[model samples]
Target: MKSTLLSLLRTGEGEFVSGEKISDQLGCSRTAVWKHIDALRKEGYTVEAAPKKGYRLAGEPDTLSVHQLKSRLPEPSFVKDILHYPSIHSTQETAHLLASEQAEEGTIVLADEQTKGKGRLGRQWHSPPETGIWMSLILRPDIEVRSAPQLTLLTAVAVVRGIKESLGLDPEIKWPNDILFNGRKAAGILTEMQAEPDRVHAIIVGLGLNVNQDYFPDELADIATSLRLEKGEKVSRTDVLEAILKEWDWLYRMFLKEGFSSVKPLWEAHALTMGKEITARTPRETLKGVAVGIDDAGVLLLRTKDGKLHHIYSADIEV
Candidate 1:
């Protein structure tokens, strides 16, 4: 009921609704409806209550509420709980802390804005509120520590597939964890886990997708493009987020039941730089090579000019 009210309030233009009408429609008393409206007003909603016209939704604050998100989700059952923040340092950071306390799987921590979001190799992920989708999913996968890296590749495929299905945009995946549209970055994935040498622990996958941002900074103008920019229309963040979770659940189940053999072929087929010439850079050294298919371990298989195939565990790659 709260989510419905919020959604209707955000419809941008609506006439004032009378208390009797709301009470009859919602099966509640007029006083009860007034209480609900008051609660919303306290939460930064500007609701106008006139003598005859009971209540009018004037303004709604920018907040990612669980009620609103779940209302938009096709399958909200898969999402156990949603922790929404108006502003946070990072959703991944909060999720990790929650995991330490044995938070349930499918627990999602989403932030409208991440002040200090991180990408691979501790790189700063540029997350501006209402410009992109910045969120994290906590999963307690039944897999060994060695198999955790494969989750990143699996998530990459899921994200690309979801984008294609939802927006009709043919996005491509860069090896490991990047979704590129029109040769520019559209989304990124960061996978973190807590495990011993052999056993497994919880894995928190952080996703940052450029959704509605129309323009990029001069430095990233040529390398970063959002879904809205590419499609020339604003995309609903809620719709995209729901699609990603649904697709991720599918891929994740496959990986658990069938292993990497199931998703490897699909990922390779959608790889953007698989057959292209590229340079893979590691902290130790950089290797120039032609991109080949990824191994079962989700390592990037780079065949250098010297005819030696190197499995890159972690690093930045340039195509």
Candidate 2:
């Protein structure tokens, strides 16, 4: 009810809203309406109240509140709560803290901006407030530890599908965790897990999608892009976020039921590196070969010139 009233107040171009109109629209008493307005005030909203005018929402902080995300969630997810911060060191770090405290699966931690966002191979991801979606999901999956790498691939599929469905644009997965649009990077996912060698514990899937950024940092000008830059229009971060959660939930359920063997074909078709000649650099050395599809264990298969197959666990690839 409070969120509804605030949304209504935002639509009005006046300095104040009549208390009677707010109470009538929300089907609450005037006192109750005032209480809601006070709560919004406490949450960093500047709402002014007057006898002639009901309540005027003058300002709102850029926090990802439960009421805000709940109104945006797709019908499929039961997003119990959202832990939001105006700025955080990292969503993954906060997610680890929540998981240690036994936060429920599907509980999301989102930040308007991340001070220390991460990517695969310990690279830093560029995240700015109101410019990208920087979020982490705390998940507890019933799967073997060895099967974990598959989750990264699975999430890539979800991100790609989400962007396509929500923005009506085609995006492809670049190997393990990169989402590419028009040969440039649009999004990246970082999956960090805490578990025993053989058992599973918690998986914090962190994703950062460049949504409305028009300019990239000089260092990232060659490789990064936002949906707005690519599509020539600003995209709704909330809509894309909901689509990603919905797609991930569906794919995750299927993965738990049948494992990676079932999703291998789809991943292969969506993979941008498949059947292309590429250079993959691992920690020890670099290899150039034809990029074949991944095996059941999610290891990259590189077909060498000597007609031999080499398995790569993690690497930065160039096509």
Model 1, range 102-147, lDDT digits (tens) per residue? 9999899998899998988868888988778899989888898888
Residue ranges of candidate 2 with Cα displaced over 4 Å: 1-65, 72-79
lDDT score for candidate 1 against the true structure: 0.84
lDDT of 2 by residue, 8-110 (tens): 8987765677888788889998888878888888877888776676677776654444575587766667455678787999999999999989998888899
Q: Give candidate 1's TM-score.
A: 0.80
Off by over 4 Å in 1: 1-65, 71-78
- Please give the range of 10 consecutive residues that has the lowest summed lDDT in model 2: 60-69
* lDDT score at residue 98, model 1, on the 0-100 scale: 97
RMSD in order of candidates = 5.1, 5.5
**lDDT values of the candidates?**
0.84, 0.84
After aligning candidate 1 to the native by TM-score, how far in Å is the CA of 181 from where it should be?
1.3
Candidate 2 has an lDDT of 0.84
